[model samples]
Target: MSEQNVIASLLDDLTQMQSLKTALCIGQDIAQYDLNKKIQWQYFNASDILNLPFTQRYDLGFVVFNDDLNRRSQLERGQIIVKLRDLWAKHVVVIAPQGDDAFMRSLGLTRIVDDALQDSQQTLWQFNILSYKNTPDWLNSKFWANPENWNKFRW
Candidate 1:
């Protein structure tokens, strides 16, 4: 599915959730959408993900990994996902290109759907962070194995 369609579908699903009141979209600028008016929306980049303030938790978070050239290292990207999960009160939705499933899964994201075809021969993987606390111990070990991950979260 196209990025627009995926986003629309996600927004639609989120809107149906009575508990979802605020959402943050990271790594992608989707300010043009009308949905922004319906929900409290905030935008951020990968560089700012780590510094994001936790004063106000969001009901949902989205990270769009569309630009391959501007991507961060595998470990760094995984860190971003972890941080996003921490900021979200309920769930985090990630839109990533194909072949990154293993990396995302290692970071504790669950694949919500099979690969969907997109333009430019790209396939999109829709992964969700439902509950960080419920993640498998093995996956959590892989995520926390890097000291950098722990250092980043240290207050």
Candidate 2:
């Protein structure tokens, strides 16, 4: 139920997805669990989240937020999530401490954790782009959907 264990479990789940060919990990390095030789995994600093290139999109993105390390404001964090959602083809997984539920919800991420990890303080959230596309009224007014903002979204 420790932070490392929680991350390992999430990595295990992500690696099991056959459709996941590439992944971008923001805020932490997750290359040690290269379970799939075919999967291309890249790590980047949290600050680079907005500056990443847009030419190539990843199948999945992992964003980890530690209280002591990620001190960005709520609005800044929301922007990061929005940008990641736009760049990811399938899904974006956000791992943060429990207090971020409201902020995560505002960014369109759904908390998918069914049970709490015994001694863990982190929570897992998922934003499935495909599902978001199908949902009614969810994407129409979101800040990221505006065509004019697309240019600014590019790094």
Candidate 3:
């Protein structure tokens, strides 16, 4: 499939993980991509993202770094990621070229995608957002902590 199509598919997959009430697509186009209707998607660019106000209004925020748009040094990129995670959205997804794998990991994000597509290097890197812990899975679930009694016990 085409690179754009592949990226679009990846985005679709992410929405399935959880019901996102809203998503903000920064420096990328989502109109061509079919996403979950349950999600309200907004696309925009800021000349100065660092100085933008912190509203934490969106459920998810995407920071797509491209040469034509949203170009910045690694340090700047790190700062933007922090800003987005802390103030702009509850969850953040970063889409960028394959660079140092450790960079995103160091920032507490997990790499979720690496694929090649038509007419381009086909190599892309996707990082997951920080997962905040609101509850423990075992607290109310009817399952045991040990596998021997997983089917018959509750914590």
Best by TM-score: 2
The model with the greater lDDT, 1 or 3, is 1
Clashing residue pairs found in predicted model 2 = none
- Candidate 2 off by > 4 Å: 15-18, 67-69, 114-118, 133-155
Extract clashing residue pairs from model 3. Answer: 116-122, 117-122
lDDT (0 to 1) per candidate: 0.66, 0.74, 0.65
* Per-residue lDDT of candidate 1, residues 53-153 (tens digit): 66777777777775642367887888777777755545777777667767777766776653344453434333344444565667765654687677567
Query: In model 1, which runs have C-alpha deviations exceeding 4 angstroms?
Result: 34-36, 68-70, 114-155
What tens-digit string does per-residue lDDT give for candidate 3 at 1-155? 47667767766777787667777777765645655466777776645667777655787777777674445667877777777777777777776656545777777676654544424542344433445444588676465355677677555
- Per-candidate TM equals 0.69, 0.73, 0.67
Q: How many angstroms is residue 125 displaced in model 3 relative to the true structure, after the best TM-score fit?
A: 5.1
RMSD of each: 11.0, 10.3, 7.2
User: Arrange candidates by lDDT, highest first: which order?
Assistant: 2, 1, 3
| For model 1, the run of ten residues with the poorest summed lDDT | 120-129
Ranking 1 against 3 by TM-score, winner: 1
TM-score of candidate 2 on Cα atoms, chains taken together = 0.73
lDDT of 2 at 44: 72
